[model samples]
Target: AEAEAIVRYIKDNPSDNIGVITPFVKQKEYIKKELESNGINNVDCGTVHAFQGDEKDVILFSLALSEHTRPETYAWLKNNRELINVSTSRARQQLYLFTDSNALERLHDPSQEDDLYDLACYVRSAGTYQLTPKPVESRALGIRPYSTATEEAFLENLTHALDNAFSDGSHYTVHKEVPVSQVFMENISSKDYFYRGRFDFVVYRRYQKKEIPVLAVELDGMEHLSDHIVKARDEQKEAICREHGFELIRVDNTYARRYHYIKEILTQYFRS
Candidate 1:
């Protein structure tokens, strides 16, 4: 529906320079494909990051958020004010935001108090200047470790396998949740780097006191198959790792029993 509305808006005002921006790469691709299918390929359509320095007479922004989306999954959207600013300020004359109003409003319902609520309200105001709410003082209850049973098991097994495979002086260190940007220096924009994401585990070898990152690993679960966002993120991570000359080993949770298979791959990588 939002894609059709954007197409209609562009057609209705042919004189206005229009652009379509979406937060998700998948949605951006879908929107572009939809426009192209309808013989409307001239208009610019891309992710918000893709239009950072560009502006148009009119811009259509799609949130691509649904009611089923977990608020915590998109917490980054609220934390990064610059991202929101870029998405909303791309239109010189008019900006149309497509979202689920009910779902957005629910994010602010006293019990939730999510930053997306502020975002939803700001978008609802049609770019009207509004002071952002002051963050409430909060205290951390405790630092509880967060890891799925499968992930924990995989980490334990992989750690043991790596320890056994590598020599004592070689110093094969296994680090978890290593940021991708730290491993590679690229000419890509900051916005793209921001979402490059983290590797579940990174294997580094210290030879003659110089540490070298040799491999990255991702533990995939059922969610990766069912959730398009997770799948897209995984693909992006794999692409970036490959581009930087790092091999990414993706192991499914179902393969947890096949420790030898993972060990063999690691052995081959280390030996080569």
Candidate 2:
């Protein structure tokens, strides 16, 4: 939630004047990778120490952890006044703070007051974004909608680009939520972990009546970062694509925004 929100803000704003400060170096590095993957390398991102003597036009502060994920660390951070003070005061124009709702669900030690809970209330973002997507749950209940806002926008633009590129009777078509194993022509081994893993979209080239699988695309956002399981899944997907002689484009939200950038990428493998 923190990473996606931060990346979206940076992509739309697109300035070196922006800064990101997270409480932990682990989360800070995770977010940095997400930004860099999206081709956003200019922003200064680090823990509070990196911003001690600096300010930015826009500042995003992410708690970047839930009690469930890291209990002792979160317990320590939620009460640290210095952490909150230094992080929030660095923003010149706009300040956005993010934390998971689950993190704030449990009460802090009432014996000693903590400012982070108070801060979460003002932001109303102790995972508010995580719960507020009612339309996603209402509309697509079965198999999607974690970060549907980003995915929806990207798919709309990508679909349009694909249509325009194949204007004279479109030859290739895009499919969403497709299984990774299906991309292969050969039979599957029963023990593979990613056999049931799904790709964001698969593009197939149509020749006569047969639709040949031509390319695969994955939209990676902040969710893809920091999770060891997700990283392992990515490595498996890449390996599968390589072994099967299939073309896979692992795109960041940065690349997904531009219809032209996506179009240019597809044209190399699937020119109409």
Candidate 3:
């Protein structure tokens, strides 16, 4: 029933990604099954101690503040502080905290507020942390941005980066608009320095065979970044891609429709 409610919340607000963290693995499994049975997608829960270096945009910290009443209870309270610090750091925009009022009062400390205030100030000071839109500028004909030498250098630089990233055999990938299944080819060779994964393309030319670079190619009638869901999806995809080693490459739809800028980029990837 709770899982159904969570799924309904997600479906109604598609912008949100659900993340659940608790102090028990059994609970995680229970919730996972409940969520799956109810058709909830991407719901994860695990022990608070197990959650580190991971984050969600919105987090529901369920630890009761009132539980830490005794000085000896401070040890248990320490976990809550750690979870709060880690959880708050994970959100890029917002955070949702739930607990009893008694617990909130118990957890409230003037010094803690100062620390949180400092962190919040730092977050706000990040100044959007969003990429500025590429402006449309017309260049004069024959004034090419790519000289043979510079182009080769640029290609080499990109190739080297991709190669280095793909040195790891296992990596994440993000494909924009392009179906996940179509991202990789089956005939990838050991010498090819790239491998096709179950979902996306893997770049393996860099190191030994450790990495797989993420790839993204835009395929909308127009740029889809303007849409919030599209943008969020793109962000989520990019995040997943980064978790592996893939980089995103955006191409105008016309690039493929006309000559083949997409192919050109791929060729350049190989050459680089």
Candidate 4:
């Protein structure tokens, strides 16, 4: 839908030196194919890296990843702020991003709190030319809501339990939905850990005045039991955490109801 709109706009405005920027090679090819099929052949489409050292009067960026996509699927783009900078800055006069608002909101990385989410908010507020369809509660521009009620309830409950368990002396702080990219791993390249995964919750113990990460937690849903990809990713995360000497605690959703068990697991690490 976004690509079609862009092509149509370019067709209407023949004089604008418009370019399409995508994060993945396959996406670039897909956009190029769409443009050619529509008989709009003048505009150039390429990945952000390919467009470096080049500038366009107007640049259309297609953020292809949706809320359902796993972080590892686009870890390279998510971790590399330089690539986003290159893509956003390549436009001399105008820049437009085609992204799902819900996906942008649901981005699960505190490290990107300023970079991605804040930038999106800034652009929405500051940009002069805006084109958004009418708001619909059931369907948000053809994108379904990202989080289900069950997930939201689980997260809330877990957060409340952690707060109650750790609120006594500030011995530990519980952070939710922390990106693995923010946590540095020893003897590993930045490229290796970039966007690899995210912890559902992280417990950081206070040492002197600084907070040090001590435990990473994951709340496994039923999907993790049956999904091979999810299992593989979880294994990879466990390996990385072990390599870095960070204890990872995996709890099934069924076990989440057992408050005593949860507290016991957390207390064991918080004291260590």
Candidate 5:
């Protein structure tokens, strides 16, 4: 749940200076690994003991100890004044606490003034949020300003192929790093989860003033994901394009670099 929250938060606020604080070094390392595996590597993650002087625009403080799992550690955490204080005080704009809410409720005694119990009360004052997990899209990973060299090569090969197939007239146009919403002609709202989605390439046919999309291309790499996760994410992207009345193609690295194969695909699609 903590990993999921961090991933979703980072996706929504891609540019924010984010940091993650956890009581245990193990949790800190695990969160860092998960983020990197998901192609998110910008946020800083550390233990609360070393986070005293640190402040970020947004901080995700994780109470790694839960009453059910580790009662002794949970008690240790609940009584530690300095740990709770440092964890709650290091965010400039937003501080999100990730914990077992049921545990918090069970541990908080209204009759007693405890350090961690008081911190739990404070978070409740700020309003507790339960984040439900959502589908993690591969196309939405690695938010960047520029396209990869592999993607650029695929576009160049596709462009040349288009020229050869439609020598008599312009039958197809190819674009790179196009936004998914723009391709689908959907109005973007801040609440839309896939608004950050971008097609690695899009194939279109121009009609004087308007360009009609027929194909959306995704250049697949290890950066997005691998194995079964890659298959699932690819299926999701394909379904999304199908819903928007276009074909979505995912090109693996070796195939993406081939000029003849790219030309052949353009010819087959636009020739008919």
Candidate 6:
């Protein structure tokens, strides 16, 4: 009842940013809609995984102890201590713990303790904190949506350059509308993969009369400079790709935005 009330309050007040911490992932969509309807931008419901290396001025931790007392409770408690620690430490000042009486009673003090007691001791005391509603942190990504025509044109221009680059009688196969496979990484085991990273456009190259596998031509968008995490992850991906004898050509999006430069990178990569 309290959780629902808080969700309703945050939704009605859009000017106030809201953070919801729930033990279960089921509440995300419900909370997201409440915030969106009120025009309160930047609402995030964090699970244990999403809380890493992230912090805010205020934190609403929903520590439902019944959640922690399930079967395999000991393993969940041990492996998840860091997650709880990180989630609790996120608040610089205000901290609101939405929990039931049963959960509150589970905290074992020197004067009182329980099976899942030590976890509650880690929470920091914000000087005289209360249940006052606070604004949420704005960590929203500003992405401009492109129309279908724009995307089609972008891919058309991108492929043209790729075709021009690899004149080794190689065919360029574009997998534009397909989803990237996360399971593809499972095939690789051990050894440092180099030229690692994500590419905007992955062009597969097929060479005639040769047993060489397809090469991947990646298109790098201009936003690469602003999104450092993606860039770093891409670097790691590229390194991994190198282990499998795959060819990777990183064509800058700025270059792809233009036909001549895109063609130049493609021709240079494939022609080599």
The C-alpha RMSD of each candidate to the native structure, in angstroms, is: 16.8, 14.1, 17.7, 19.1, 16.0, 14.0
lDDT of model 3 at residue 244? 46
In terms of lDDT, the best-performing candidate is 2
lDDT of 4 at 103: 70
By how many angstroms RMSD does model 2 differ from the true structure? Answer: 14.1
For residues 1-272, could you state the per-residue lDDT of candidate 2 as single tens digits? Answer: 78988899888887548888888888888899999999998998998778755657677888876656655675677656556655654554566777777666564554544456655654564323221112211211111212344466678787777778765786777788898767776534443745767789988878899878888888864324533445677788777777777788878654545688887877765653
The per-candidate count of clashes, in order, stands at 0, 2, 17, 0, 0, 22
- Cα-based lDDT at residue 182, candidate 1: 72
Alpha-carbon lDDT, every model? 0.65, 0.67, 0.41, 0.64, 0.65, 0.48
- Candidate 5: residue 216 Cα off by (Å): 64
Which prediction has more favorable TM-score, 1 or 5?
A: 1
Q: How far is candidate 5 from the true structure (C-alpha RMSD, Å)?
A: 16.0
Q: What is the Cα-based lDDT of residue 180 in candidate 6?
A: 29
lDDT: which is higher, 2 or 6?
A: 2
| Candidate 6 per-residue lDDT over residues 1-272, each given as its tens digit | 43566566565655644566655565555555665675656766767556544445566666544545543443354325344444544444444666555645543333422212333332333222221121111111102112233345558877676565654675766655322232144446553332232344466555675332355555443223334454565576666566666666665432334577666665665557
Candidate 1 lDDT over 1-272, as tens digits, reads 66777777877887888888887788888889888887886789888667755667688888776777577645655444444555544565566787777766654445543444554554577535243334222201001111244455667778778877766556677788888877776735444743547888888877887778888887664335433455666777766776677799877644544578778878887788
Off by over 4 Å in 2: 1-95, 98-146, 166-170, 187-191, 270-272
Error of 3 at 4 (Å): 10
Least lDDT summed over 10 consecutive residues: which range in candidate 1? 137-146
Q: Supply candidate 1's per-residue lDDT for 217.
A: 83
Q: Name the runs in model 1 displaced over 4 angstroms.
A: 109-116, 126-130, 135-272
Quality of model 1 by C-alpha lDDT: 0.65
Model 3 per-residue lDDT at 50: 50
Report the lDDT tens digits of candidate 5 across residue range 39-157.
98788888876664555778888876455555566667765655654554456567787877887777665564355654555466673422112233312222221134445666788
Instruction: Give the higher-lDDT candidate: 4 or 6.
Output: 4
* Model 6 lDDT, residue 137, Cα: 15
TM of each candidate vs. truth: 0.44, 0.49, 0.32, 0.43, 0.43, 0.37
**Residue 26 displacement (Å), model 2:** 33
Residue 172 CA error for candidate 6 (Å)? 2.3
